[model samples]
Target: MSHPVDIHVGRKLKQARTLRRMSQTDVARHLKLSFQQIQKYEIGSNRIAASRLYDLSRILDVPTAYFFEGLGDAPEVGARDHGLDIVSAVASIKDEQVKSRIVTFIEDVSGRTVAKSA
Candidate 1:
């Protein structure tokens, strides 16, 4: 059975894929996996192994810790709330350049807005 962590990881994967305007076929081909495999990963029908998780993190350009950002604990003081809103907002972006710009914008804002978090 897939763990809650696996489900969260899948959600993150799908979010990143949509943010980059990439299709499951595209990501599957890039990762040398089948679209069905990608689907399974995205839906939490199967658990991703550690090596695959590393590959996913590398391919998605997200940190490995992203999958476990707030697992098994309450929110920390001042910890950034990572809601589904950001994922939906990212998925709504149509242009890749716009997405990149948004990412950069977030990075910039995070650098300033949460300076203490650094």
Candidate 2:
């Protein structure tokens, strides 16, 4: 059986990759591994070593801590929240206007104001 921690990490990995708009092949190429290996890692079928995780962090342009976010929470609960991934992806947008527009669109659709940071 796959460990809960491992499954959590895999989901985070996949989430980061998706937020970055990267294919499994793209991430695999950066790590010099096959796409199947990337799939395995994302499915929790294979455990990722520390070095590999570091590499993934760099490739995904996220801090190492990103993978561990919400780890203390129940996996099902954490998995249901895509807010972090959306926020991260939006924050990565270099164009301020585009980011602002996206935030506005989200607020319009959700009918809730997102507090802006100073």
Best by lDDT: 2
lDDT, model 2, position 82? 63
Off by over 4 Å in 2: 75-79, 82-118
Which candidate tops TM-score? Answer: 2
Could you give me the TM-score of model 2 versus the true structure?
Answer: 0.67
Candidates' C-alpha lDDT: 0.74, 0.81
Expressed as tens digits, the lDDT of each residue in 15-79 for candidate 1 is 66765556789889888999999999988888888988888777777788877665677767887
lDDT tens digits by residue: candidate 2, 58-95: 98887898888988876564455667567667867889
- Each candidate: RMSD: 6.5, 7.3
Off by over 4 Å in 1: 74-82, 93-118
